[model samples]
Target: MISRHRKVLREARVVGSERRGTWVYYWVLPPALERLPALLQVPEPAASTSW
Candidate 1:
């Protein structure tokens, strides 16, 4: 018998920066966070509590 573990694969992201009057988000981060800063070069939506 063998036991296995299940891990969820969710690409969670938050707003970072904006440009060209556009709002972008890092919905899917790269292999690491460090890479995100250099990769993501845009702005995210404004934070809101109105779900």
Candidate 2:
């Protein structure tokens, strides 16, 4: 549940959701977002929205 922890990182904000399909978009806070790739190391869906 990285998405949940993403909140703890204080760097994630729910930007949008795709009701047509199962997907969510998040705005990863800059600095943290930068480090996220290395930290969580998970493949995320392509984000298509901004908070």
Candidate 3:
């Protein structure tokens, strides 16, 4: 799972990470930060639902 996440971040070039001992830390890059709000938004649910 960690490898998968790392691969995505590396491919997107949207994050940076550093390893300290047994743990890894990650942070969003400046370019991605600007888009984070849009990326994190969830669309509204449908106006109608059928049971």
Q: Specify the highest-lDDT model's number.
A: 3
Which of the two, 1 or 3, has more TM-score? 3
How well is each residue in 1-51 modelled by candidate 1, as lDDT tens digits?
111111122323322223345643223344557666776788788888875
TM-score of each: 0.20, 0.25, 0.56
Each model's total of backbone clashes: 4, 0, 0
> How much is 21 displaced in model 2, in angstroms?
30
lDDT of 3 at 36: 88
Best by TM-score: 3
Candidate 3 Cα outliers beyond 4 Å, as residue runs: 17-26, 49-51
| Candidate 2 C-alpha lDDT tens digits along 11-40 | 343232234457655554466556766987
Residue 22, model 1, lDDT? 65
- Candidate 3 lDDT tens digits, 1-51: 989988799789899888899998888889988998999999998799779
- Enumerate residue pairs that collide in model 3: none
